[model samples]
Target: MLKELDPLLHSQLRLGVMSLLMGAESAEFTFLKEKTNATAGNLSVQLDKLSEAGYITIEKTFRGKKPLTRCRITRKGIKAFEEYVQALKGYIK
Candidate 1:
């Protein structure tokens, strides 16, 4: 039997975000938006999903007076992404 895939990691935006975060310490909201080519609203929604899944950590703070959002992938996210890739490889073979 095939292994079950993580639904959260399968999402395009969420996957992109995790892939990027996997490489960096953390990323700003604008950087993620540009990299993913996602709309602000869409990205925000997807981010909430990732956060709720405990796959990523979101830090909200004030940069002077404006709000700043930063994202970092959790250990669980890395493991999930790796497993997702392995599951996909099984299908390709």
Candidate 2:
């Protein structure tokens, strides 16, 4: 039987976010938006869901005069992503 996929990370945008976060220390909101080709409002909402799940951390601060938002995957997120990959493998084979 195929393993169940994580509903949260299963989202294309969220999955893209996690996939990108795995490669770097942290990512700025604009960078994720650009990479995922997501709208600002949509990305913000998805980020909130991940944050609520404790899978990622969101830091909001000011960079000079502008608001700066950065996201970093947590240990929980790494484990979740890894498991998600493993589960996907089960289906592929």
Candidate 3:
């Protein structure tokens, strides 16, 4: 039997976010939006979902006078992403 994939990370946008975060120390909302080509509303929703699951952390602060949002994957997220990859690989074999 094939292993089950993580439904949360299964989303294209969500997976893209995770992949990007995996490579960087952190990423900003604007960068994620540009990279994923996702709308602000949609990206905010996905980020909330990931944060709710403890897969990522969202930090809100001011960059000078402008509000800035930054995202970083948690250790839990790294492990989950790795497992998700392994589970997906099971399907190809």
Model 1 residue 40 CA deviation (Å) reads 0.6
TM-score of each: 0.93, 0.98, 0.98
lDDT at residue 18 of model 3 (Cα atoms):
98
lDDT of candidate 3 vs native? Answer: 0.98
Question: Residue 80, candidate 2: how far off, in angstroms?
Answer: 0.4
Candidate 3 residue runs with Cα over 4 Å from true position:
none
Cα lDDT tens digits, model 3, 1-93, are: 998999999999999999999999999999999999999999999999999999999999999999999999999999999999999999888
TM-score of 3: 0.98
Number of backbone collisions per candidate, in order? 0, 0, 0
Residues 1-93 of candidate 2: C-alpha lDDT, one tens digit per residue: 899999999989999999999999999999999999999999999999999999999999999999999999999999999999999999889
Ten residues in sequence with the least summed lDDT for candidate 2: 9-18
Reference-based lDDT, residue 72, model 2: 98
Query: What is the model-wide C-alpha lDDT for candidate 2?
Result: 0.97
Candidate 1 per-residue C-alpha lDDT over 37-81 given as tens digits, one digit per residue, 9 for 90 to 100: 999999999999999988899999999999999999898888888
Q: Against the correct fold, how does model 2 do in TM-score?
A: 0.98
Per-residue error for 32 in candidate 3, Å, reads 0.3
